[model samples]
Structure formats: structure tokens, C-alpha cells
Target: CPPIGLESHRIDDDQLLASSMLRHGLGAQRGRLNMQAGTNEDDFYDGAWCAEDDGRTHWLEGDTRRTTKFTGVITQGRDSQIHEDFVTSFYVGFSNDSQNWVMYSNGYEEMMFYGNVDKDTPVLTEFPEPVVARYIRIYPQRWNGSLCLRLEVLGCPLSSVSSYYAQQNEVTSTDNLDFRHHSYKDMRQLMKVVNEECPTITRIYNIGKSSRGLKIYAMEVSDNPGEHETGEPEFRYTAGLHGNEVLGRELLLLLLQFLCREFQAGNSRVRNLVTQTRIHIVPSLNPDGYELASQAGSELGNWALGHWTEEGYDLFENFPDLASALWAAEERKLVPHKFPNHHIPIPEHYLAEDTMVAVETRAIMAWMDKNPFVLGANLQGGEKLVSYPFDTARPLSETLAAAPRPPDYEDDHPELQETPDHAIFRWLAISYASAHLTMSETFRGGCHTQDVTDAMGIVQGAKWHPRAGSMNDFSYLHTNCLELSVYLGCDKFPHESELQQEWENNKESLLTFMEQVHRGIKGLVRDQQGEPIANATIVVGGINHNVKTAASGDYWRILNPGEYRVWARAEGYNPSVKTCSVFYDIGATQCDFVLARSNWKRIREIMAMNGNRPI
Candidate 1:
């Protein structure tokens, strides 16, 4: 019989019985199994090897060359001309050499993995934890008439920085190339394939539909798929907002593939990221525009046709004009300390039924309202630098006419508005810029000579070029997510041949930015009874801007290293304050709050009936 197999990896533990091996490298040495083969009387006839059913003493085994880490394994039943036999249950064993071996255990005892029930279908069983071994043997305790198997060891070579890099490093670009950009359908298929291959850590979801009724998809990569975990900071990377700017979309797709592959291969850095952070990647926000852009091919057709949505709206500039509203709120404030810098509400006009806001923009707004995302980056093109919010600043007239403001206010730079989290935002921007291949190069001027040259490869968004209703500003003002506008390069749409280099240029930055989600403080706010309190306001002393806890009672705040007082308060609870010392050497500092319910509940109920709330 032949081996019908899927590639996967796994590890084992101690207490093994004596068993003879068939041979090493069953899948690696031999050619691939007939993936399309069925029980055609000749299926797996010559490809599979079977062990003698001598009282369950005989077993099949293979070698991994050197010491290697395994995550799971894929196995198949046999379908030969003479017989149809398969192992229904089996035990896996691992060893450094061929002599002493450890049985794959469920932490309590040896685990018996289920094999294929039929002859052709493949069964995959992943290990509870990663196993390190060179030799892997299968002990079939139970079989369907006979102990026959075909298998493949799924894993990478030895783990090393250089090897990892070498595995991902692509060939140099040339004029004659076979590369082509993925169409909307191709992108969807690619995402689906990734989700299928790495189902444990990936989830495919649709935020909404495009103007042309195309589903706008977003993929989440996390240890716990589909649901957000408490205390874990949520981060997002969105691209293809302007469909003509294709590099960001390609880079994100590449990133999705890379993360899935590396995580399965037992890459520690990637494993930690997947386990600790909830990452959201929206590869194409404007699928309608992308479809138009992709129709243009690599170097022909209208480049400007897909710069916006099918309805001819710039998605970036289609959000609610919250910048003006924020400015207005600030101007009407009785005191400088009472300025509304965080969680600014959307103006009513933008949410009206007859408004011309793009459907994609509204979907994103609703998405933001649901997820407590702490960090985000919007990938774009036409330059090579990272610009952090506020992307929209107070008008020059207002800056000149307003009364005295806070000390951090920059009257001299009216076009640039600094958030209370400016230092942290700048640090995040620099982290990405410095990690990028050429974004921080001082000698290179800019992608296009006319672009602004920043020594740190970063700038304030409004300072670079103010635009109303920018996504960066919208993200900052309307939600807990602080976002940066990352300009990939000068070319809005480059040839597909350049995608490899483009991915290489942005890979490290993408990984680093996701890792930055852990750099700030995060925790939960609960009442005296230990129940989580939703919508609790968390205010850092001396910073007017504040954040609200999610429905899970968890909150994440990105802060620079410093000692400061943090407070968590609910409407009917006594606010609790604590002093936290954030350090540069560690991940987010944990700061939990336990608020006590106020005794004036009856008074609050009376006030509620009167349509009034206590301060």
C-alpha cells in the first residue's frame, strides 16, 4: 500500500516498549504520496510500507536527520491491490538516537492518537507541546485488520536566526520575471488557504461589504482565535485603503503566510507573539478599488482608477471629521485641564442616514467600536516614512485666536497637534522606521526628492501634510487604538517583481510593531465583588487624555517609561488610584484596579429617573 499523508510534526515523552523500526525518513526520503489517489486497487501499492502484525511488537519509524523540533504529524491508511488496511490507533515515540525513546504523552500518561478510519483520508494530530527529537516511531496498538501506515514528518530544519532568514530570503528581482499581483479572488483564496493550513491560530472574518458588494475580509492571528483574551493587547495592521497602493496589501499577505509558517515550525519569537498578542490584519480594506487596480496588471492601465472606492470616495478622508469637533470641544472647555483629548465622539452629521460616508469607512468605524485595539498602523504608499497622529490639527486661525493652552501645546507649530501620548507614539513610529530597511536612511533624501526628509524617518502626520478625516486621526480620536500612517514607498503601484524586496523591507518593521503592543501597561478593572466593570475610565495622572476599559474590564495603555499615577473609575463606584513605575527593560507593567461601589446607589437611581447623572 502507498502512504497518503499530510505534513505535520510532533514530540513525545518517556516510557517506551521495545519495537523494531521499518526505516528512517519514510516521507522525506521517498517521493511524495499520490495525493489524488483513492481505493483504485492500485492506490499506495508501492509507496507505503507495513510492519508485521507479530503481537503488536513490530512498529514503523522514521528519522528527522538531526535533532529537530516537531509540532504535529499527518498519517494515512493503506490502499493496495491486495488489501485495504490501516492503523486505527497508534502511539508515537521520540528519541535523540535510535536506542532510548520517550512515548508521546498527554502530560499524565502515554497518549494514543487516532489514525485514519478509511484507506485514503489523512488524519492530523498535533502535539500538546513541541517535542525535540531526531527519531520518531509509531506503535500501532490497534489496527483495522492489519498494521499498515504511511506518514510524513512536518517540521523545519534546526532553529537558528540565520537559517530562518535564509529560508525566507527571496531571489533577486530581474526584468524577466514570472511574478504577478494577486487579484481580489486570488487574495481571498490565499487567505482561506492560510486559515485552512493553520486553523489553530488563524481566523477569517468579514467586517462588512464593499460598495460593489465584495466582502472585505480581515484575518486574526492569535493563540485563541475568534475571541479576544483578557489582558492581551489588541493590535491591527490595515492596508489597501487606497487600492492603487498595492505594496502594503502584498506585504500584509506575505506577513500572514510568514507568521503561519514560522509559528508551525516552532519559531520561539513568533510563537510568543501569537500566544501573547491579538493581531488583526485587514489586507484589503477597499476591495472594490483593489479589483479595479488589479485589472491594470503590473505596469499598464489607469493607476488612478483604484485610488479610491468604486463610489469614488477616498476611504481615508471619508471618516467623520472628528478633528474639527475635537478642536471645538477644546475651545469651549472652561479649563485647560478639562480638554476632551481622548474618546472623542463622532459628530451627528457624519452618522446621518443621508451622509456620503463610504461603506468601507463605516464598517471600519464599527469594527473599532467593538475591538479594544491598543496599537495600529495604516500602510500606504507615495513616500517612505512613518507619521503618527494627530493627522488633522487645529486650524491656524483657532490656534492663534484661542486662549492660553497647556504647556505641551505648540503655538509655533500650529499645523502639528500633539496628543498626550505623543512621546510614546513617536517612539513607536521610530521603532518601525529604524527597523525598516531604507526608511531611516539619512543620506537617501526621500523616495521622491520632493518628500520631506526626516532624520528619524518619522514625522507628525499633520506636520507632514494635514488632511481632514484621516484614518489615523479617526482611529486616535474615536477609539483606544493609537495609529500611525506608514508610507511604504514612492510608488503607489509597483511591478509584482518588486514585491519580494518590498516584503523584505517591511517584514521586520511589521513584526516589531506587533511586538510593541506589549511595551505599555495593561490590566483589568473590577468592582469590590471582583466582577469586571465595563466602560470604566482609566486616567493617568497629569495626562488629560484617558482610556476606557473594554467589556471584559480590561484596558491597555501605551506609555513611555516613567512613574505615574493611574486611576480607574466607574460611574457608581469609588475610583481607585495606583502609582506604577514603567521600565524600558520590561514588557507592559501590570496595574489592576479594584473599585468600591458607592453607597449612594439610591441617589443615583433617583438622578437617573430625572435624566441626570452624578459627577
Candidate 2:
């Protein structure tokens, strides 16, 4: 016949015959019956099978044992061939024991292949119902001389393959430039992104809503979640209190982004602050006002007065009750209907009420009540200056005398009495005056109180209401927290171009102002035993500054630098006095006393007793 002979050969029975023929003439000349030509027949051989006398035994390695899954090399040997005439087919048999095997070929048609092949072919099989295959036989029938067989079985389970792909696609996306702007929506979105990215360090809270119904968000940036629960000293920075002051709003947003970035990069100072102290930020307090102001020019069709009405009264004037009245009067004279439309008496609308008297004030008050360690500043603008407390009117208890003494009519002095409650208003007035300076640029007017008042009246359409419900007053009176009102001045409404210059001019002064406030609070006088001594007298003789401590042993005094006598006295002891010299920029002083008993009175009593005793 041709090289395609041997139609009568039985593949299973001809093993020895083929080996013998391969070594002899017919097999040697044809290279052992051209076993490479029958390499494709190996696909039917079940490569893992070992032939015994009666049957073939097949096994799989790995997790496939005792399971009907035949898992090993599925693609058989590397060098097997298939003839074009005889189609290649494979049959797999399963058995629970070493004997009595059953063919699974009928139900799993996918387990068989019928195509001409060259090279070792995989015995394709379906993962049907799992069977414990103690033996599997792969039979190839009706193969030409060129056909050969081999088999490969898989040993890995299906679930592991699925799991690998499942995990391969789950990487989080990272894009830079994510938080470069101050858009409210962008900020909110960035916060969400940050929270997701850094779950261990960040949390956000919705404080309330702005007047325009937009969500007013306050982000509590901290490392420890417990910090919020502990009610620790919280530093709060609120921007855009006046809707038109847009730079602060933008700056606050940028600051938040910067903080988040720096924190993620392992900045120690920021990280420590976020963990140790609660940092609260209200980026835009007056969102409604901002939106209105930002859209003013476009909507109103006027660049000179943008959305801001020419008659719109300044919010800074709405401080004390008198100032509020002045503001209301000015508003009535300017845009009578437009002025008070948004000005409500509720605490949130007034800084004094908001910080010291109103509901919003209660929010901060509650915070202060819990955290006595707070130190903060409220930022405002109109004049580039810092104004401390006692802005409204001094409390009635301050006096000029430095020591405890009975009133003398020759001095024309007012009623002076030492009580448990003494006014430190004078102390506050002098301290703030000495520490900070109001802007010196005068508005082309004479330097007289009346002249200034009249000029303000002409511009504002009312007498200057200098004092009102102010936050600084409340901070000094109600809490131990050190707070200051920072008035960042601009010659006119701040424009985008001037913001950098304005900040450059005021940054150092602002920090120094804060430091002074810090030192003043931190360096209060204590007694010799380190206990805060009550009623300790501090006299700044340069400006004739004099004040007494309260029951709490807290005193605040401000005066020019000079040589002065400071004294402390108690009822049972001789008074103590000291002469000391002070210098400018010396923020505070600590002087304590240990007094001895007065001997003059006791000696006089002894002399009187001797006279009575007839000595």
C-alpha cells in the first residue's frame, strides 16, 4: 500500500509490534514506523496513563485528586502527528477504584476532537460533574500510520483562575491637579476623594446651611478621630465673613488643599496639629452674599457698583448696639428698603451676638466652654489695623489708684472701693492701645475726636457708633480663651491684583499681633508659691495705668514703658512693693510676693498694756 498503510493495526495491541518493527527493517527504514507522524495520536493516549496487563491507570496531581476532574497536562506530548484521513478523537473514563472504569464520553461531547493534527494535541475535556477517577482511558480508533496520540490534564481548580482576574482590575485611580481651585463643588468633591484615599486621617462634617440654601461645610481636619470627642482646644479660621471679601475665601480653600496634600506627604507639624488640636475651617460664611457679590457686575450691568449696591451699608458697623443703630440709620438714609432686608437681629447676623450672644455664638461658646485652651483670631477688613477689646465702653470697675487706700477728698477722685469684682477694662484698653496701632493715614481731616466723628457721620450719614456687641468684648469677659480681632485694612475694596500685595504688607504684623495676644494670656502674674495670686496690683506709671486682679487672679494691663512701682497687699500682712523698669515690646511681667506681718500695731498694743499693768 502506500506510506498511509496499516488500516488493520490495533493501536493498543501493537505497542511491542511497533517497537520491534521500529528496530527492524520495515520500522528502521521508516524510522520506527514514523512515530512522529502518529504524534497526533498521543492526544488519545492520556499521557498520564500507565499500561498494566489488563487495563491502563491514569492519575492527576495537585488538588485534583479524588475528584472526577482530570487536571494535568491537557495538551499531551510535543511530537505527535495526525493523518488527514482518520479524524482524531479522545475518550476519558473514570473509576472510583483501580478497577471497573466507566467512559464519560457520551455526555461530554466537548471532550472529543475530530480534526487532522500534527504534533501532540490536547485532550480537550469539559469540567462536568466532578468524579473520582481512579483510572481514565483515552482511546484512539481507526488512525492511519501517521496518527499519534498523547494527553494533558489540568490540575488547578476553576475558582483560582476566576479570583486572579477579579483582583487584577481593582486598582484605585490617581490623578494630580485634583484639588487646585476654590470652587465649592470642587472642594466638596476633593474632600470626598481625600476621605476615601486617606481613611485613617480625615473626617468631614456638615455644620449647617448657608442663607442661600447651599450646604455650609466645616471640615474637622485631624489625625485622631478622638480629638473631636475630647473637646480640646480647636483653632478655627473662618473666611468670607463679609461676602465681598473674596480673597480670604479663596485663600482658605487653597489652604485646605495644601494641608491635605502636605498631610498625605507626612508633614510632621500638620500631622501633629491634625491629631493634637482640632482645626476647624469655615471657608465661606456668607455664601449667599458671595454669590450675590460675585455676580453683581454681570447681573446689574454696572462695573463701578457691581452687584454691591452703592447704598449697601458696611457690616463692620454692626457691632455694639449703638453701632448697629448707626448702621441701621445709615442704611435707611442710603438704600432704605435694601439695607435691612437681610440684616436680621438673630445672633448669626451680628459678630458680637454671633460670638457672644446668639445661636451661632452659642456654637463657639459651647466650644469655648469645653476647651479653655483655645487661642484664635477673628479676621475682618475695612481698615488695615488690629483692634483689641474695650471697643464699646469700659466696664465701670476700673480705678486709677495702684494700692488699696481710703478715698481722699483732696484728690477730687471718684468713688474707689475694692470689691471681689474689679473692672479690668482699663487694663484691656491700655494693653490693646500699647500693643497695636490704628492706621495713621488720615482722610484729609483735622485730628480732633469731634472732627473725626463728624467726618464719619458725613460719610455714613450718622454719628459714629463706636461701641456695640463685639466678639472681642465677649472673649475677654466670658472665657479664658485668648482671642483677638484682626482688622486687615485695604485702602479700598480689595481687588484680585492687590491681594498679594495686601497680604505681603500685613502678614508679619498679623503674626506679631497674634504673638502679643498669646504672650499676654500665657504670662499672667502668679504668686511666690506659683499660685495665681488674686488682687495683685499692676501699675504702668508711664500712662498712669493701674489695675487689680480678680478673684481668679487674672489681670490684663497695657501701658507705655517706664519705671514704675508695683505692689501687692493683703489685710493681715505688710504691703509689698517693687520698683521695676520695662521696655517696649516686653509683652508681660510676672511678679510675686511673700509678705511679713506689720509690727507697729502689735508694739503699740504692748505699750498700752504695760501702762495699765503699773510696771
- Please count the clashing residue pairs in each candidate, in the order shown: 10, 36
Q: Per-residue lDDT for 37 in model 2?
A: 28
lDDT of 1: 0.74
Deviation from native of the Cα of residue 295 in model 1, angstroms: 1.7
**Tens-digit lDDT track of model 2 for 1-615:** 011111101111222111122112122112111122222233332212222211222221112223334532232322322222222444455565536757654464535434224332223344455444433444443243422333323332222222453244223323133322245676577667766766676677755554345665666666664254332334556655565555555545545655677688987755655665556666665555566556532112111221121224233333334323433444346423443211123343444533323233334444444443344555654333334443453222333345465766354223321111112322322233233322333232211111232222111111122344555444443444334544444221343433344343433333333333323211234544555555454443333223444444554433334555666554444667776554555344444455555676776688798984634
Per residue, candidate 1 scores C-alpha lDDT tens digits across 1-615 of 011112101111121222432332122222122212222433221334455334676666665445567776667665355657667888888888788989999889999888777666556667778788766777778877556665655544464322343335434533222235788888888999999989999999999999999998999999999998988889999999998788888888888888898899899999999999999999899988888877755333232558889989999878877778777766677323555567777878878988998989999999999899999998987677999877776676555656677888655555567877889898999989999876886554543232364588898877767778988888887798889889887556665645766776787899998888888688899987899999999899887778899999999888888998998988889888899888886489999999988877878778989889554
On a 0 to 100 scale, what is the lDDT of residue 558 in model 2?
32
Residue 39 accuracy (lDDT) in model 2: 22
Give each model's whole-structure lDDT: 0.74, 0.40
TM-score of 1: 0.68
Candidate 2 overall Cα lDDT vs. reference?
Answer: 0.40
